[model samples]
Target chain A: MSDKTSRRTPGPVYVGLDMGSSRSKVVVIDEAGKLLGHAVKKSGTDFSRTAKACLDSALEMAGAEFDDIAGAMSTGYGRSNVGFVTEESKTEIGCLAKGGYHHFPEAITIIDIGGQDNKIIKLDAAGHRLNFKMNRKCAAGTGAFLEEMSARLDVSLEEMNHLARDAREMIKLGSYCTVFSATEVLESIRNGKNVNDIVKGIFYSMIRRVLEMDSLTERVVMTGGVVAHNAYLVEMVDEMIGRPVLLAEYPQLMGAVGAALYARDENQSAGATTAQASSKGE
Target chain B: MAAGKSTTRKKIQATDLMNQVMSDYFYHLNEAATSGKQKVAWCTSVGPAELLRALGFAVHFPENHAAMLGATRMSTELIPEANSAGYSPDICSYLTADIGAWMKNITPLSKAYPGIESVPKPDVLVYNTNQCRDVQDWFSWYSKELGVPAIGISSPKNVVEVTEGHIDDVARQIEALIPTLEAISGNKLDMQRLRETVTLSRECSELWKKVLETATATPAPLTFFDGTIHMGPAVCLRGTQEAIDYYRVLLAELQGRVEAGVAAVDDESLRIYWEGMPVWGRLRQNSDLFAGLRTSVLASTYCSSWIFPSFDADNPIRSMAKAYLELFIVRSDAYKERYIKGMLEKYRIDGIIYHDAKTCPYNSNSRYGLPQRVEADTGIPCLVLSGDLNDLRCVSDEQTKTNIEAFVEQLQERQ
Candidate 1:
């Protein structure tokens, strides 16, 4: 409730803000890389305001003040707009790879289906990125696609997921384009196709789209707000990939977590450099 | 790899002379078009320009003009005019933009040169399909519209090895064009003149190759962006002494930079090989983006397409046929892979970026699993960027910037 600049605390905490297109998420972590608190809010037209609000709520939960923050990093579509980040904003691909590796600590492929884009990042055992791919200049495999299909199906996003789970026979939509698939959904409704089946088909279409973007590694970790809300999609991906996949503790907050980890790592390295310089002077 | 410190790129002094050279070249073409004293021949960028020169004709390249339209950002507006006239949007934007500009009675040339109303009107339009069949269709459309004789050589496609048979076929085709060229120019083909022109072209190509090879030095003297611009002489004035002379100047400037340790991109820690057509509309933006990231795009398949190692003045016709046939665009995937691998090693390239040009499928090499194969064989990473050579509508600036940044970060991590 207090102004951020006026508050003071005793210890240092790192901050990571994933200012994505659909949502702004902030994670507060201690010096030991342990998550202290996190917050997520809708990222409307004004990204800067949303980022501040998420940071305030997250800091409040962590019982920390502005003076306690050691370093900060930002990622995602709105990263550049976040004025408070101390480090150069990283790409969502790098943040995702770092966050995913923190969880598994091994060679893993991170699939992040976000609001307007989807990413598949591959990282080695040492947390170095091997390769990464983002969906081409189309909205087909992202959360935006699901929202459009849900709107056409006359259901809320949550209702669509629930309906998908209830379907006995999955209806397959033929078109990959979000607009064309809406028309196909209308045609299915005209042909007396089951609504639940149609909803399941939409989920299947989204999963299929991401699958075609790139081949997956053996250890696949699913993250992002889409999978966080629509758990059925994760199950579908598992079924499709023919293996169990790891899910981050907070799927939508993984990029923020990754950004926080970067802040911590960078701060420690700077401290080591300063210590070495001072010791040499002595 | 730590990020390189940002510094202003060293300007190549030859650009001033290149500007004058280009202005004079266009001035002569306009003079020929307006004065009606000499015949003006429209040739493809990689067509037999030496032969055209020997036959006593002033040359104009539409591909060069289309690139100007693209660089000046005029193609996006004019392309619709051609699309409205039934040219598919999926074909080469170079063809569509050129035809579209012609339909609109506009050109980037008019603005660059005072008193020039449009591109030089052709007395004869010649094409070589070694690049693509689209050039033949493009030239044919203009031929029908202007009632000019359109002559072309149907060079073999997906050529793996340029056999003597292929050379003979193309040689006879070149020989076949003489009658029409003589009729149009009101001059006969002079073998001695042709041989002289071929010699000039050979010298010019070697100098251009040396200019590009200067990037093999640490902290490369020039970037691929520089090559794309400085290549103007090599592409448009290949058969003339002016081109040979201009390259000698450019080569010396580059060599001076290399000796003095001046780099085109400051702190050039990462060296990259660009594997497809330059995103013509976004050249400055892309160039600055890479420079800011401290990555030097030192080599590319597109700019090197003009290098004709096969040109031999002693056997001008057959060697010209061999040179034209051995073009990189016409080569098979296996041969292309080998060529790219060699370039990566030659340039000490740390990474490769393939621009999957939407309209230029012939030049876009990323679609056939070439990127993965190269990465696998060479242990160098590759990034595929989806864009077009001339169509700005197909390119996503924000997406491309993010991809390049991430690719640089990935490479840095490996280091």
Candidate 2:
């Protein structure tokens, strides 16, 4: 049988759960580091319930049973709420860095614009984290800011993205605060500004907020749900920074994939230690 | 599957002695306020306690009282009151909280010690701008409200080196204060008494420095949180035998812990240097957080501010000026970088956490690209925590915990 076919009849699988503020995500991977399946859903108020549901969906898609999980790790804002995780929970920053490095495998800065916070993590060529910074105690440049702005502009998030892409001219926003920007958005509407231009302006404001947080490295990788939905933002970043930025294949599931990678490595290390112990005893 | 363990670090035995020392200090201040037997002089914490003591005035530090208000979780509510009274929220929270407590006619003192109705009424107010210009403004407001004489030494700031000229200027200012202090205390300035008080302060400072130096030991026996509480006597009772005696006991206890190889935090693998003012209200929370992470914050700029090594009893005036001007808060960025690098080597620090306190810009060192510079120079990682000395509103406990955990993970990755 082929290795892929053999893996499909899985004896064991590793799992990673990212319990974020807005959405919960889970990824299942086999011994060979091949992604088997993944699932994402709204986090809502009950994190524990949402985490369990995501895990169940991911496992179902992977064609694996509960007994097949060899190891599991949790991460994100609600990481501690995931009761099924078998190892110590990791921070979203470390997980995102690991996930981004797994794809790029180069010196790069990872800009993760998440639901509640934005993180800029710089890594060396050896996959070592050189430095990192998170947004200060504010939601000015995060996914929540976009969501709030969408509601204020009376447009669906997807429509906002489309409008931003089709804009003839970008309308620049003056306020960095979400509340203040909402007032500015109303004024733009009163001035009979094009909705498409205003939406592009909101995108410009969000990009400006993240860019101003820290200087970007030569190789920048953009990830998270914000980038997953708003592909136009990558183009905007390219135009602003005068360089192209890489996008993760599975942006929203990067943290979950990173957690799975950790679980796989840890389980292998434990197995190797046990094997060495057994040989010494013999 | 399971939650992480909570911090279970053993409390230092010296804490009990610190409590007794602080209670007695407040009791004396209460006596001065109520009985009017002694004139009460409100001085800044880093201001000249020796001068006031020599002039026969009972010294009370409003900064210390403001710290108490923060520790007791009263500052957050009181800060807004000061803001409503036309004081901007961006000024020092210590100033706002103290002035607000005054406006509300309440003091944590009354709750801590029996028969203490309020803070001691100041007969005169004195300040030094070595720490920040805020102290003068903080003291001036009270001086106006109470209709008392206000005087201050306008020391030069961002001092790279405390030159002879700087010492001369500050010394002349301090000497000029003798007339007003003498007028308030109804006593002549006795040079002999001033020398004796300066001698006592020097002795107390040396003992405090030695106590802090004990943290150089691997798996430090005491953390910065311990020093913050135990520093009460050094701040309030300096220039008195009480502070000297208290430090001797505290130092003995710490030395015993070092001999026994007892660590303040269990499995203490990471030694961190805290580069700014503490989140005063969350001392216990922050302490437990670091301990739970197996990280010991062994040294800090805020706690080390009281260790005036240049104090000379022989040349009291000049030495006091040099010592106060040499404070970490008053130093330029270049000087601060060198000092922090020395501290990193001294403490064997694995990381640096700079608190960017919202209100106290003078003490917040992270805003000026210092963290990146320090990290690049030392090749040791640095994390900046956003917090305030007195305002809990400026702090986010969840965010702080996440950032610290990630920073620790990065340090571990380096290892």
Candidate 3:
């Protein structure tokens, strides 16, 4: 028996924990398969501790305790670092795909630009994964690159997104290497180029680097905290791909939402198995 | 470094035996001069080991030694030594690492194990262009350095079918090599001995094919990582009775393991097939990622390269030429895909992991559009991973883990 059985509550809730590289997120859903509560916290050195804290906060927001959660599932970089997840944990790819499919029931390609890497996932009409591609050992287009660029420009990351909108002329940065691109960003500054234009150029280059990873399908769904925080990046992606990009509901929480969805499935299946066994006994 | 968490996964028994056989193989080669009977011939991985063995030569594959250098984490120190020489960083890593090992006079194997040189010096060198042109250039440089005569065989490139004419062409080269080999070893090439050597070579290939086929079982008893090491005898001593004996022992152990419901990966949840050569320096790191996910990379094209379906001992040179020339690596993309699809079905492979080696253009050249084509045909997901065979700096461990996690997720979604 799981911890859920030991604490047995009649409320029937599902919990999801997404222990990411930068942040950990938790989502709680009720028996009706409706979102009850969610929480996000920074993922420090102790991923498990951060996950537990996020789960506790989510449970509290739902006006419930740990006993109410019938099942739990974990996803993301620190997924294996967690302890209380009921089912075998999923990878971010599966969670993102499920989340993307739940919102848009069509053939979709998800471009999840996370902290350290970018993933291009293709899904069929039935939400089955057709194929996927990830950036090759490079951090050029990731949030980490943007953060490094922000540090170099001496501008806040939140301010950098809005700064791109003020640019009159876009100065395209060339190098894909983060260190080289940082030097190029500095060189543009020395050449009397406007900071706004340079920042816009950085965004354009980041989008271009991701576009080069793999060809996208007709319907593209963008996810992850990078897009959740920066709306301008989504518009840039929309213009570059010449298609209106679909965003997941609570884009940063999509992985957690998907994990919660999987947890609900496990809980329902377990209930069905128990009911069938009791009926057979009758 | 991802936390070096010790896994409870059981080690394959054949791996230990393979390590012993490989260590003994290197020791014998180092002591060849003292033996006074066995001559050493430096050859390519896909070179004709049977012909060399028929002449009583201890065949040494430099590619195998280069992989060992990469696996033992010595490539970083050695690759630069060759880069300082004429060879650029973009050249095939096997060439750079092997040349670099010679220049630096250091090998991780030598440092770890006593009384064993990394690789034995060659009395003669053999070059074959069946796989890539790098072997030709690599062997030519060593031939010049060691003052030994070099024998060359160039197979037809980009041909759909390897014809009798092509076989005859390669066979003529094989016949030409007899005089040079006979001159070095001070022995005549007996036709009966050559036939016997080819027979043993055929048996070894047959057993190797069976060993790889055994991985088709659910929760495979062996992994591609195990195959990479277990493949040493097939490459180094393919024509010898010793290699045949090694496979017999290995096949029995693996068979027993399968019968007992043992797995290479303890919790084999997904079965994947690996394509291209391993990222040797990070083998353990990459393997741990799969083992962590309960994914079993059951088979690979690299380990199965020695499997020749048509090795006829009745016609030695012609059969040998056909086997070497018909390798899937030398074939076109369409042919390669067809072979990959066949393996996918045979192994019940859930996905394909194509390792895109940065330094090896010849191997990874056609890999860009491969995943799309493979997915369209088989409906099986394919993940293209970027890493170098010998260069440790070319790949990122963190990014590789992320890619693997995502790929595993993709597999789970499909299931």
What DockQ does every candidate get? 0.49, 0.48, 0.34
Give model 1's TM-score for chain A to 2 decimal places: 0.94
Candidate 1 local lDDT, residue A12: 93
Please give, for residues B197-273, the per-residue lDDT of candidate 3 as tens digits.
89988999999988888898877988898888788888887887778888988999889888988888877889998
Candidate 2's C-alpha runs over 4 A off are A1-8, B1-4
Candidate 3 lDDT over A192-232, as tens digits, reads 89999999999999999999988887699998888998899
CA lDDT of every candidate: 0.90, 0.89, 0.83
lDDT of 2 by residue, A1-282 (tens): 111222245768999998898889999889886788788999999988998898887887787888899989899888888775564688888899888888889999999999999999999999999888988888888999999999988999888778999999978989888999989999999999999999999999999999998989859999899999988988999999999989877899899998888888889999999999999995
Q: For model 3 chain B, where is the 10-residue window of minimal lDDT?
A: B1-10
**Candidate 1: misplaced stretches above 4 Å?**
A1-10, B1-7
Cα displacement (angstroms), candidate 3, residue B109, comes to 4.4
So what's the TM-score on candidate 3?
A: 0.88
**For model 1, how does the per-residue alpha-carbon lDDT over A19-95 read when each residue is reduced to its tens digit?**
89899999998888878878899999998899889988888878888878998999888888887655368888888
Q: Give the runs in model 3 whose Cα sits over 4 Å from its true position.
A: A1-13, A41-69, A84-88, B1-23, B34-37, B84-89, B108-113, B140-151, B175-179, B217-221, B253-270, B281-295, B365-368, B412-415
Q: Candidate 1 clashing pairs?
A: none
